[model samples]
Target: MANHELLKLTANQVKKGNYNKAILAIGSCEAHGLHLPEGTDTLVSYKLSCMVADRVDGLLVLPPVTVGYSGHYDTFPFTITLAYDTVIQVIYDILESVLRNGINRIFLMNGHDGNIAPIEIAARKIKEKYPDARIAALPQWWVTAGELLPPDTFEVWNGLGHGGEGETSIVYYLFPEWCEKELATCVVPDHLPDKIEIKWDFAELTNTGNTGDATKATVEKGEKMTKVLVDCVVDAIKKLDAVNWDYSSTNAASKL
Candidate 1:
């Protein structure tokens, strides 16, 4: 198999490969209940990126940004929080580096909610600076996994939550030894109304430092989730490659 990991490849190998696209995994370091490891977010996104890169030709997996903005989850033990502006700058710089390397197409695989806004801002800033640059993202694979899977896949809260069924299950599938499944717990916030967004701190939602029914997570469910998520990303990258990452319509009637 051709090595698609940029970190592992030599400079000569990268030149010979002529890679033009890259995947950047953005993740966070924070508490994920008492069961999952603090590096859960990083591990999931990075692993997913590697998987996608392995299957996609000319796609390189860049080293991940392992820490992200986690101020909302700081109430939990051992949470590393970066300032929002700092996060934006970090992402911006990474994208700039990729552009400098002659790669104009980039895909961001994000593993944490708090990094969403920063990723958006950074991507936009890079686009403004380099109009020819094409950037795509899977900002929330957790939500996408739930949507892609069958309705009956998860048992509670649709497998949504920090260290919840879906997240825990994926970890169980990817890194079972890292997960203390016996210590897994959940506290679904029933008071929070659906369809109405609540800006509650991690503390306000659950004392366990996690929400949703983690006890329902299973290795089987996790395997299904991983397959769907990987397939989703693989399909997207292949389609984007087909179009040369150009979405502009050629129709004369659509011309602005």
Candidate 2:
């Protein structure tokens, strides 16, 4: 059976039950090297949320927030971003509106790295206002695809990077036709001196705007990685629903 998606349901159907948990997928519209599409983050994150919704009962997947805080990629064409404050306000407002409908359990699945700080800030502020509500936000990259996959599965890149091996592999598995593997190449930034903090741009990193060895990506690895990712998300949702502890007495009562 197909999972329930908020955008696909009617108002009457949505109001007929006590569905308290919801998923809000957040991603970005920005450059992803030469082979991957600009919509890579949004596509992968939204799809992953949908997969989780199908497995976990009473979970409704919200339409994804495709545009995120990506000012660092302004040099690239067709990239869009929201101001930090704007993103935070948007998240807070969305959560408030969701609360109005009695859906207090929110899993914020973020696919963009740049939106982490704003999302965390918004989550904290929301908890301060709505103690009973639970909001959890995490970047999908933190899943550690390398560790999840078999030890000998990959040869070049072992971690997630911008349009790198991990991201490219997943994209290929999900939408092979959309992936331009022929153009995929390896490009990483030079090693930096320890403790040398500096502001840098994608242009300064590599000539192709890529940050990892995309040439090593394969569809088989992507499939395995995606399976583990889905399991992780399903486990998170289950754990969130299983919590029975009361947060009524604590200032940090909001459970992610």
Candidate 3:
């Protein structure tokens, strides 16, 4: 609802200035169990970006990159994925475009876990090209959401699982129409002792295609979680904006 979306802004409005920081919300379109919608990651990323951009000064929210790498969920129907190299190139191009337009402060708010590495790789490449550019890739829902929640609020894995308590609760509060509460199901995988790691397709992990406890999710918890996450986002964006990023010719001058 706020005027944070850059796509809706006119060229004259954009040239009016004040918006120096741009956020690119990156997510994936994939199976998020039976209860959650396929566009869960994209929705969350866009919503969080809007919330942050609206609250922070000189922040503009760009349209989200809805499709991301989801090869791990190949067994699940309707899951879309891009090659690792392809994703990196896509992020690089987007960043390059924005940076060239004079928006050097960039934040890639990642909603899907699979896009994390690619976003980071792209950010590194951008830094190599533009030494004055300030870029960051934040794992918005993965790390930040769980950190905002109380330790006792959810089980160990429930707070940070695919279509689990955290995500289900978020959807319930933000978009109740999209949440299928009646069909909510849980499918936590068995833990291997000695920290042994086992990787497999979606079907191999869980028939329901969900991990953690969705049954435990409630709209009330979702409301609280959303507030905390939004506040965290606003605070983080403001703090990052205030930091000095003149590590360009200034550093070279010191050497000289």
Candidate 4:
């Protein structure tokens, strides 16, 4: 059926009321480093979204949200970010659209750290509006972060920012030609000493505006990370209990 996500659904998949669940990629279009393109965030998020959608038959896939909240990355030249409120609106709008389509379950596939807040907000709001809806917003990395990379590469200090080894690794695996192999340097950000704030306009902290080492990133590691994370999300969905205690369908529908 041409990959669930890419499939141009016929009226048949539409009328069976066959839609049971869906995976939405909440990504961002912004700069990473000199080497990586601005859409790295959206790219990884989309991969995770598709991975989850491919599993568990009744799930439909939605296009990735290419623009998301990224306030922390505005200092960079090509970095693009939406205000906190605007991003919240985007998420809210998308969730409503999916809920209207008889989709009771939603998995928010997140790739950007900055997207954490708005995603959380949207999750909560989705629940409030549609009491029967089951929505989970989980960052793509949080699930398989441990299993994907070596313990030594964790780099607890500088990971809070953008365009780091973690992100680069994912991109490298998906698109090796686009990655710069030598960008991941050992030098930690200056803010490591302060230990208060690691990312943002604190230009003095970063020697290269990169939090972690992108040069150390490898396609192998990224591939492993992607698999781990994707598998984790699919596992979580399967493990979930069916419609907790209450059996009611709110027949409300929304349009995109």
Q: Which regions of candidate 1 deviate over 4 angstroms?
A: 251-256
Q: In model 3, where do residues sit more than 4 Å from their true spots?
A: 156-158, 192-197, 245-256
lDDT tens digits by residue: candidate 3, 1-256: 4586888988887878478889999999998888899999999888888988878878888889989889998777689999989999999999999988989988788889889889989999998999888986677565576777778777647376788888888888888898788988877777644457566666777878788788888888788777887787777777666665343453454544
Q: What is the C-alpha RMSD of each candidate to the true structure, in Å?
A: 1.2, 3.8, 3.1, 6.5
The clash count of every prediction, one per candidate, is: 0, 0, 0, 5
Question: Each model's C-alpha lDDT?
Answer: 0.94, 0.81, 0.82, 0.70
Q: Report lDDT (Cα) of residue 79, candidate 4.
A: 67
* Residue 134, model 1: Cα distance from true site in angstroms: 0.3
Arrange candidates by TM-score, highest first: which order? Answer: 1, 3, 2, 4
Query: By the lDDT metric, which is better: model 1 or model 3?
Result: 1
Sorted on lDDT, best first, the list reads 1, 3, 2, 4
Candidate 3 similarity to native, TM-score: 0.90
- After TM-score superposition, what is the CA distance of residue 243 in candidate 4 from its true location, in Å? 7.0
- Cα lDDT of model 2 by residue, 1-256, tens digit: 7647888888887776446789898899988887988988889888888988889888888988888898888777778999999999888888888988888889888888878888888888988999988877556553466777777777764645688888889899987888788999888666745569557777777777667889988898788878988888788778767764233454766678
Please, what are the lDDT tens digits per residue for candidate 4 over residues 86-170?
A: 9888998889988887777887888777788888887788889888888876764643475454676445432334566666777
The stretch of ten residues in a row with the least summed lDDT in candidate 3 is 245-254
Superposed on all Cα atoms, model 1 deviates from the true structure by an RMSD in Å of 1.2
